[model samples]
Target chain A: MDRMLSADEIVRGLLAKEFSAAEVFRSSLERVRRMDPALSAMLSVTEEAGMAAARAVDECVARGEDPGPLAGVPVVLKDNMCYRAAPTTCGSRMLERWTPPYDAAVVTALEGAGAVILGKTNMDEFAMGGSTEYSAFGPASNPWDPDRVPGGSSGGSAVAVAAGYVPVALGSDTGGSIRQPASYCGVYGMKPTYGLVSRRGLVAFASSLDQIGPFARTAADLARMLSVIAAPDPGDGTSSRRARPEYGAAVASASLKGRKIAVVRELAGMKASLSPDVEGTLARVLDLCRREGAEIVEVSLPRSLEFGLPCYYILAPAEASSNLARFDGVRYGFSRKERTLKALYERTRGEGFGPEVKRRILTGTYVLSSGYYDAYYLTAQKVRQLMKEEFRKAFASCDLIALPTAPTPAFRKGELVDDPIQMYLADIFTLPVNLAGLPALSLNGGFTADARPLPVGVQLIAPQWGEEGLLSAAAVLERHLGPASVAPMAAVKGGDGR
Target chain B: MTVSERDVRHVAELARLHVEDDEIVGLVGHFTGIMAHFNALARAGEEGRLPLDDLSPVVFAHDEIPPLRADEVVESSVGRAVLDAAPDAREGFFVVPRIMEGDE
Candidate 1:
């Protein structure tokens, strides 16, 4: 069973002349070619461009020049993250043929670090849905069980890493897009502190909540990739200038000695809401922390968890409605032929966007409407502030907070597609962190009791700019979890019979 | 608060999405189901009624002032390519339906 090499192994091997960077890239694309038809994880594969990038790395090595830290590593981009002149569909007809004029800050960073850009991966239409079912292209199949969903709107990126297609892929977390899907697909996904990574070329979903991060099979890869993309960018107004702790060094020197991790009273009381699998996974992770001499104290976040989803729904859509207005036919998205100007605007958007995208745009407009503005949007914002305060007090007693990444494991596809609320509920655990502009790392904690492997994820939430804390904890957890469990038949499973 | 089909229609109009009659049936039900959750938020349960602070909205979570770049005219390499992507384009602008029904 050939597995994709971890980023560290690939870099070391490339330098050691074990294989050329081209071979590593070709191997990755070969696996994509072998498996992606059924999985539908990829929207496009930039084979020629990727090969050219690989050649550059190999030439650097051949000429006795230093290849960068992530040399030969292949990265898949969540389609919403722009790559210059590539179709960044974001799984919608609206941007079907649209190519971004510039590369996203993350893309530029990855290329600078010598990572090969494989191509754009599928996502929910404008990253609206929990499952990739909302993807206009198609649902990305869960690696563990083909019948289940690869939780999205970063589903394709997660599946790519989980199925051993690539070592690293980038996903944006606005609400729980990155973390929940990583939990479902059995990988590590981080939503770095809001301003830690630049949002320069990321098509904005919810500006405040959105942060670009990586999905990887190992915590080491998570840290290494984070180091590359987490630099302050002049291009993004929100990119913070605060000095960042060396992320790679944090993972390398990960320790649990005297680390005070808080278990929130709010999470403890919600045993009934958590699955048996999730409960067991959290308990085991806590036990491991305890064994490592980390103190686990109980703290209270009160209604923070309960109000998180409601607050997120109100605020994200309100922000999305404004950000997505650029898609009018007059600008650069999907234009159409129409008799009247108003009809052109309406018909172009109607025909271009999928059902889920339209639903969100409408919902966003409804939330921002004059009558409902104060009642819904304003209240949600106020609640968001209170939630942030509760977390501030909780962090007073501990170094970081721990919780289940999702309420459950990867749900069977079509199980909740018709139920929009149920789909939104999939992100219940992960959204609270986003609302607070906190850093969270979702990593594979344990597996289910099935005769086969179904991975469960546990998250560590840290205060603003606390990515170092999350990385250290994740590095320790990865050692105990053995290695990420790649689904045996991941290549063959499709949610909707692809 | 109850949401009517008329409300959804108005929202869709504001959003510039012309949804069909059949789609509206599902859209109405979907919006209603979601609002039911918001309705739960409205209900002041023990969890919702917890002593919360009367805090203002923290719009941008980070407080650091954004660093501004020096204004400079940088030629875009993809300007022509962007124009080429338009469904209809002429003279450095995206073309769309004429403003009037009976005009050039």
Candidate 2:
């Protein structure tokens, strides 16, 4: 209980009666209370409900029942996912007081697996920004350095794991929300292939792009967390009906022998943007792959690297504009009492949404408006298809493709907050995989050699439904790169508990 | 591509957002900057940089169609809970501002 325990260890210990489930939950809650004040990782801590769930697990164990794979494990969720017990705020004031009526598909899955729901974590308002700075509550500071921003919009979820509040946390990634923040925080985060995870009860951002995934300190924990939630749900039309493999078992004996890993050749052209730490980390990971009997090859993704940002900006916002139209002060959330419907919609949206959400909505509206649809939205879609083709061709000769999760390590908190475009560039390397709808995982490659050493991540992407390959490669890489370490709570510069 | 404040306001109105006049300057700058970057797709197509001339917009990433569940009715017990979460609800219907000025 003194240090962060992985979900696997917690489950085993719970079965062995090494510690009561209530004791484990209390210790994790204690850690959150102690560390999260400075990090601001969680938006709401569901102490009463979490303790109740832990007691239920303890009862099952006492009765000689299995209690399930994740019995007594502590887990946090991004605020976007609905849980009947907690307010589903999505880090926005609009839904600050809204409590979901039902649990998200993943939420139900985790509960069934005996994982205690710790709380909901903060994120960018409506999952639109790269930094949690867009959160209406306030930004979550990087655990490695309080002065630096945790890459987000899943910053809080990433911080929860990195600061040892929990071993596993769920986050939704529309672009690089999970991966970039995981990289910045030095944890393992994965964005499953689109449709592999159910989206039911998850607040829609860009319906097609948003995917709920997990953040964990070790590859095995990530695999276990994913195994529980990767099943199909009837509530979501886009959820895959295919059977999911046993992810934990797949990673347990994974080997990199004879696997072909590809490096993006086009990354050379963008060298000026890549930081030395990130570049060196990628090189070292590749060397590790080579030493593990894997071949490192090169593939070109010229269109994906150069045009993915523009393509994603257009398509994601176009969908977001449509998806967000539901928040018109009518059904739920914050509402303004206006005399007319138009006034109500305008005022509620203008006052309710943050600047980044408003900006994306306006951009989406512009691209999809009259006389502009074919030029921007349609053009971006074509480019997206072209990107898919590029990945398809690249994967024909490689089992996996590796890239830096972000162009650089975590930056100063306010550095790019004012520059929306500059902030978007932080996800440049991770976006193409999302655009292509391929499964990808970000593993902590190494850390920068500074006084406050920020972690850098190496991303591994696989073909559609190729999560096994991504996990297999990650499991092997984790063996060499070493599992990610939890940042000390004292590393935070000034603990004002902002 | 240049996006003026007028364009910004028009787009905001289309999206039903109330943009403050002072914020329009920043909105216009964001619109112009993002559009300039987005224009790269069109430019690449025109320059034949990628094979986009006859490419089709991808509806989904995979080739197989998503399997549909059997068409059947399932009882939902969350109706009352859903209604309870609404900002304003009368009976079972959501209460909203009147749509028509004369009808109200």
Q: Worst ten-residue run, lDDT, model 2 chain B?
A: B95-104
After superposing candidate 2 on the true structure, give the runs of residues whose Cα lies further than 4 Å from its correct spot.
A493-498, B102-104
Per residue, candidate 1 scores C-alpha lDDT tens digits across A1-498 of: 176689999999999998998999899988899888778899999999999999999999999888998898999999999897479998998898888878898888899999999988888899998889999888988877777889998999999999888999999999889999999889999999989999888999888888999999888899999999999987788899887766899888999989999887877678887899999999999999998889999888775778888888888888888888888787676887887778888888888888877777888898889877876777787788888888898899899898899999988888988887888887888888888889998988888887545789898999989898898988887778765766665335433334
RMSD of 2: 1.6
- lDDT by residue (tens digit), candidate 2, A52-116: 99999999999998898899999999999999898999888889999999999999999999999
> Cα RMSD to native, each candidate?
2.6, 1.6
The per-model DockQ list reads: 0.56, 0.73
Displacement of the residue B40 alpha carbon in candidate 2, Å: 1.5
Clash list (residue pairs), candidate 1: none
lDDT (Cα atoms) of all candidates against the true structure = 0.85, 0.90
Score every model by TM-score: 0.95, 0.98
